[model samples]
Target: MMITEALRLQSQGSKHLHFLIDVNDEQIIYSNQSFINQFSDIKNPAALLPYIENEDLKYVMEKYLACKSGEKVEDFESRVYIDGKRHVYKIAAALLIISTGQHIVGCDAEDITDLKDYINVLNEHNKKKNSILNIVSHDLMGPIGIIQSLSGLLNDPEKKTDEQRLYQYIDLINRTSKKCIALIRNFINQEFLESSGVSVVKKKSN
Candidate 1:
């Protein structure tokens, strides 16, 4: 016996939210226990539109319509509200033809809220690291340029005519070097504090 797409997907994962909709009347003909429990006896897919995030509603609706029109939809992520709490789902849909030659749209949605949250945390960490690198690069250039100019003067005999002037140049270079050190230390400290606030743990393995 050949298994239909809807049946195959339904058998694949028990935790997934699975449903089948009649393409003609757009009625939800079949729904798994998980879907009925989460959505509470919704008549059709359109009934769940209000629970989808506003920003994602348009895109999700487009995909839904495409599935209804017999188009295969790739996996897409969207945030939805279930029981007044936000959840992320990776959704996919495909056209299913029954033995009677009737067309149906098979949809499978997986809960991926935890995975999305983890990815977001990693992205935020990368943004913070990039910000620190940009600031350190911009802030250190000025002091480093000053030190280079002063060191060039000390190396040239023509620019070192007077002892007092030479000593002043050396002092300025010292102060500029200290400023660079302070800038580095301050940024390092801030980065350390920010990294400490993250939930990630560093483990060293030999």
Candidate 2:
């Protein structure tokens, strides 16, 4: 199928599909009803040209101009807002030479806003999960190590009956228990910092 025919068919199916065709060195074409209605003050494509000074459109037009000179242009993705709602679009363009030998650029755009939003949500969820894992690991380490050390000392045959060794083991257990308490306190402080959107930083004094 011809590129123009395919573009027309797509415009008919998707109400949000917008276009701008450079015709006869003087006119621009658009298939989106919302665009036409919202920018009615521009009256025609010529007047609308000045308002479409966005970076994405500028890049697209530059590539389209290059394609007219027999250079191949690849598809690109960009975000646009129409009627206050953000839309992510993938744009593809091709150059066509008519029977009159006039070169025209045919562009097609597809909306992918929903897919981009879903991916953003997944990314946020992963970040929160990682933060929680870090907090949990830090909190659990001291207690688990103390339990391991205490169990080892209690299981030692020779040290089990020695009073001095038993007292030393008790001192170690006490120190480890204090460490576990400190870990819990640190976890609480971290939680407060996170809730307040504040980060923990080391102080450097001159």
Candidate 3:
């Protein structure tokens, strides 16, 4: 009754899946409909490796064998291709005993494709935020440094530069100060755009 109730609950949840495998044969004894639907071509359970992406196959099999051998195995998280699309699954396996006194391995698989995609989006946003901060920091320092240097030159007690050079320094300072104001405005606009809008990759031009 408990097993039936659990299987019913799994179907109701929709995102979760459960599987029972024969420990000695590695054949699937039972699986929720969701899991069976994913591998509709299954002639045998061992064909399972074909559905898993190549990179994840070895690790997944290793962990499954560990569970069968009664050794500690870390939970396996891997990607599988289903219906021509990639999906992520979090899997955990353990030993189980059926009413017929058969020892089997039970695996719980949960689809996490949506969660992974959401996390990727958040990571991109973080990158954009960091990019804006970096640009503002570097841009602000450049103009401020120019003004400080020019002011020091003008205040020199031994100011020996020609009158024309002094005028040139004053012009440079004016231009730098104006540019600094523009930089501040850009920072504000970039912040607003990035925080509430889609993350855009800003390319720097020389």
Candidate 4:
């Protein structure tokens, strides 16, 4: 009776909090606006039982029951569906002992979808940047090395007697070397600027 009254009061005053399942051994609950909105598609609490068959939720429920049986439960996390859309939830559950030896499990969930998406985007950007750097370093290094080697060969008087041809080779080497250096410098400068901007934005957010 007390559990019923408490649940009723919680449901009435705490609209954002929901009790999705109440079992003999364990229960499922969530207290988050996003979670509530996501579960609004469920016509009734009973409809949520089959959906909770997720591996993560199953693990959470097992741990919750163990804790209620006087076993220690460490913090756990799992993915759950809200409104038919899948989301990663960081969940924490605790056991409450009521009068008459009745045990109640309290659960809380936090949506980490946005955080996960942000991490994925960062990973993809890093992969693309690494690919571009590999191309620049390998493709540009070979030509630059060839230009320097040819310039050295032309500088050796023993190798060639044509002064005009030597001068032409020197000029070509100088122009190509300067262009390569400029390209590298520009790439480095752009990377530094972008890094600085990201740092500034992070600082502002903090």
Candidate 5:
């Protein structure tokens, strides 16, 4: 009756995986429908260790052991593979003691794979945006600085530049301006391709 009530109260037609285990025997006392459906092969709590990703296996095991040792286990997220597909789960567990002096560990696991993936996508996009801004700032500064320097030289009253030299500086500024325009176009194109999930191969040009 205790197991049944606990399962009903925790699961109650929820999609979250729920299970109860005998802490002493490390055996599954009961598993809700969602738990059974999601992990049909997981006979006991110990059996879940193999499914957890190697990097997260130790942390998850630590939490489980803490819960079994009568310690309050805080909720945590872990990555695991289910049927060859990677999934992230937010796990929470509590220890329950029945009237018979038996210790039961009740666990709840909520799948958050989609949420993690979305967050990862947003992070990648943010990184790309910052990278684009840095590259544009660095590349665009060179030609602009050259134009400014040439304009300063032309406007200087102390030094008289000959007509030929003046024409040379003006031609150089025109070429630099055109180069700046080309650079802007390239950056815009690259940003568009990246945002659209297209691969970009960077090449060097004069």
Candidate 6:
């Protein structure tokens, strides 16, 4: 929007960028000071296209065209490159009409680069944590299930029929107990390894 009054200058502050385009004349009418200071090269919509990411450009243009048809676009997130650095922006566009019945599209954009970076890091951490949980649930269950099944036989007097069967069950239980202990150690060591710098070391084979 054009700075016709004193209040207009105060409205466009340094926090966000604002620009206006004349829908009737198909020209960029005005750009706020913050917009000009940051995007000095982008004077018009055509000049701004190259800086917009492919997907973001498509979405923003769709919203811009919608605004021409008297539709409002709000919280439209888009990626734009300013001096080779990518930045996320929350944009809103709306159709505006002054007393003269002149149609204009008012677009407001707020930089949200820091917020987007923080969300991406959180998503990556969630993925790694889920992978560790899967190993604990599936891999460790095998030895535990074997030990539980043999434990029942060892406890039952009727199931422990002969000397040979007794030795077999005892040996199986011993080996399963060792396997379970190793799994527990590995799980604990892995947790400490990622959080700090401590982990279990496997014995080297000759």
Better of 1 and 5 by lDDT: 5
Q: Report each candidate's C-alpha RMSD, comma-separated, in the order given.
A: 4.1, 10.2, 5.7, 5.8, 6.7, 8.0
TM-score of each: 0.81, 0.57, 0.80, 0.57, 0.84, 0.77
TM-score of 1: 0.81
- Cα-based lDDT for every prediction: 0.83, 0.62, 0.78, 0.61, 0.84, 0.78
Q: Write the per-residue lDDT of candidate 3 for residues 34-94, one digit (tens) a residue.
A: 7767775353567888779999988888887788877654456899887789999988788
Candidate 4's displacement at residue 55, Å, is: 7.1
TM-score of 5: 0.84
- Rate residue 16 of model 2 by lDDT: 55
In lDDT terms, which candidate is top?
A: 5
Between candidates 4 and 5, the one scoring higher on lDDT is 5
Those runs of model 1 whose alpha carbons end farther than 4 Å from true positions after fitting are: 1-13, 193-206
Q: The CA-based lDDT of model 4 is what? A: 0.61
Mind giving the per-residue lDDT tens digits that candidate 6 earns over 96-199?
Answer: 99889999998889998877765665565567768988987787788778878777777887764578887888898898888878887998887776544211
lDDT of 5 at 47: 82
**TM-score, structure 3 vs. true:** 0.80
Give the C-alpha lDDT of model 1: 0.83
Model 4 regions more than 4 Å off: 1-36, 40-75, 161-206
* Over 4 Å off, model 2: 1-10, 23-26, 34-62, 71-75, 160-206
What is the Cα root-mean-square deviation between model 2 and the actual structure?
Answer: 10.2
Model 6 pairs whose backbones collide: none
- Quote model 6's TM-score: 0.77
What are the clash counts of all predictions, listed in order? 0, 0, 0, 0, 0, 0
